[model samples]
Target: MRVPIYQVDAFTKRRFAGNPAAVVVLPSFPSDTVMRAVAAENNLAETAFLVQEEGQYHLRWFTPAVEVPLCGHATLATAAVVMERLSPNLGGVVFQTASGELPVARSADGYVLDFPSRPSEKVSSPPDVSKALGIMPTEVYRNQFNYLAVLDDARNVRDLQPDLVAIAGLDRSGIIVTAPGDDGYDFVSRYFAPAKGVPEDPVTGAAHCMLAPYWAERSGRSSFVAYQASRRGGEVVCRLCGDRVELEGSCVFYLEGQADISL
Candidate 1:
């Protein structure tokens, strides 16, 4: 069998500067084993599979090692594919995912992703966390998905060189280190998730679900511009609206091809 595939760099207007996700638009849902194999073969942070159902698209994201409940960059990349290639007439698209109904709409700047807000609670930092990260966070918070670590400076967040082996042994999904941004950006963050097969992510959308609310309370603002200071940097426009967070970023196509694999 043959499967169509697309590689898209999300959260950046230019290629190779953002998180790249593999998108496969399928006529029907493939078996879990097959999807996992495809994702492993692609070896990207996330592989998004789309199947149109009842005029909406059902989307699933897989890492090389496991399936994740939520992913931001992949969803944005999928929206770009739907808008520009799959359904050119669509100005927006609703994606049914494990997280719930996610809506993506085209905006003047790029595309806006409406995601549920994930507010974290202050918690004591784990000893292993500090040992792994090499620096103790100013504050630590925990949510259902991951841990949020706050630092005093954006440089601290960017300069971190974590022990990936120790991080992979942590109990949670991952750790997000963030601090106030400079040079016009409101906040800056870096994500590490060795457990999920991503040692470090270039730009993470889902992490901002927690970040937007946290910063809103601290800075007393509802809108923000965020930067993820990874080797390949990317930016995100964030907005907090009650229980929801809006993440906006641009996507660029990297490659379009077919995967020749038999089911």
Candidate 2:
């Protein structure tokens, strides 16, 4: 079957600037092997699968190498697809995902994704983590993604050049280096997941699930701006509301294609 595919640049208003996510909206669930092959064929960071069921959309994320449990940018990109294509008047979209029920609403500013509060617990980063990076963070914490390294400044986050081989040896999801943003934005961050085949993600939305709340408290602003200082940079509008976080960003449709895959 020729599955309709969409390529979107998430977290940025400009085309070809933000993290790109390939979206495949299938009439029904496709075979695992077929989906993986489709994702691999796309060769993007994450390919989102969307299917409608019981009045809600079922969403799944797949990296170029493997399927992931949760993904933020692609989710936002899916919301954009739904609004722009599936239902222009959806007003809001609900995604029943592995993480749980997630809602994306169209706000005056942009699309707001209400995600669960993923607060990283205060903990010590593994020594091997810093050893691998050749630098230590001022503070460390633990979350679903591994170590959250609080750097001295945004420049440090930008200056990180880790030994990918050593990073792959560590027992962690990935390392997040963050510091206050110099560009009008609240904070700047970069994600490294060599273990997962992505040496450095251009703009990691899931990592910021924790990052939004973490910086919100420190910056003492319920609403703040953020920038992912990756080579293919992106920007995000974040809001902290109690234990939940609202991550907002724009998505640009880059291309449309077809994936012919059969089980």
Candidate 3:
């Protein structure tokens, strides 16, 4: 069958400035192997697939190597695909996912995603961790994903050369290093998920689940803007609540095509 697919640049208006996600709004979910092959072929960090069911959509995310429980930018891309291509006339949509239920609403400004706020716990930085990162961080912590490194400044967040092979061996999924921004943004971050096959995620909304709250308390700012320092930068607006976090960003559809596969 010929399946329709879309390539969206999440968190940026420009085509190549943000994280590229392959969104496939399929009539039905494909097989696990097929989905993995599609993601590998697309060669992006995440590929999102969705099918409507019971007034909500069943959404699944696949990396080239594995399927993740949740993915923020790809979720945003799925919402954009639903708003513009899947069901263009619909007001909004909800996704039933492995991470429970996720909702997406269409706003005049942009899309807002309500996700669980994962507060990190402060911990001593392992000497090897800093050596693997090639920079010494001011502080280190463990979030749900992996180590969270608070650098001296945003410049440090961008300047370090990560030892990806060594990082992959550390444990957990990956690491996120961040610091306060110097310019317009409130904070800057870079994600390294070698276990997930992503050395440096261009824009990681998922990482900010921990970053937003950590910096919010430190900076005395409840709401803040974050930027990923990857070469293709992406923007994120985040709000830290008691136990919930909200992320807002825009997604631009770069291309729409068809996937030919034998079933």
The lDDT of each candidate is 0.93, 0.85, 0.87
lDDT per residue as tens, model 2, 1-263: 87888999999888989899989998888888888888888888889999997777999988877888788899989999999888998889899998899999997755889887778887776788788777888888777666788888888888889888887787777888898889787889988887776788888878888897788768767887889998989998878789888888888889987877775
Candidate 3 lDDT tens digits, 1-263: 78888999998978888999998877788799998888888899999988876677899999888999889999999999988876889777788999878888887767988888889899888887898899888999896677898897888888878999988898668889898887898989999987887878889878888888898779888899889999999999899878878889999889899987544
TM-scores vs. true structure, each candidate? 0.98, 0.95, 0.96
Write one digit per residue (lDDT tens) for candidate 1, span 142-231: 898888989999889888999999988988889999999977899999999999999998899999999999999999999999999999
Ten residues in a row with the worst lDDT in model 1?
A: 254-263
lDDT assessment of candidate 3? 0.87
Runs in model 1 deviating more than 4 A are none
* Number of the candidate with higher lDDT, 2 or 3: 3
lDDT of 3 at 238: 94
Root-mean-square deviation of candidate 1? 0.9
Candidate 2: segments with Cα more than 4 A from true spot:
none
> Which runs in model 3 stand beyond 4 Å of their true positions?
none
Per lDDT, the best of the predicted structures is 1
* TM-score sort, best first: 1, 3, 2
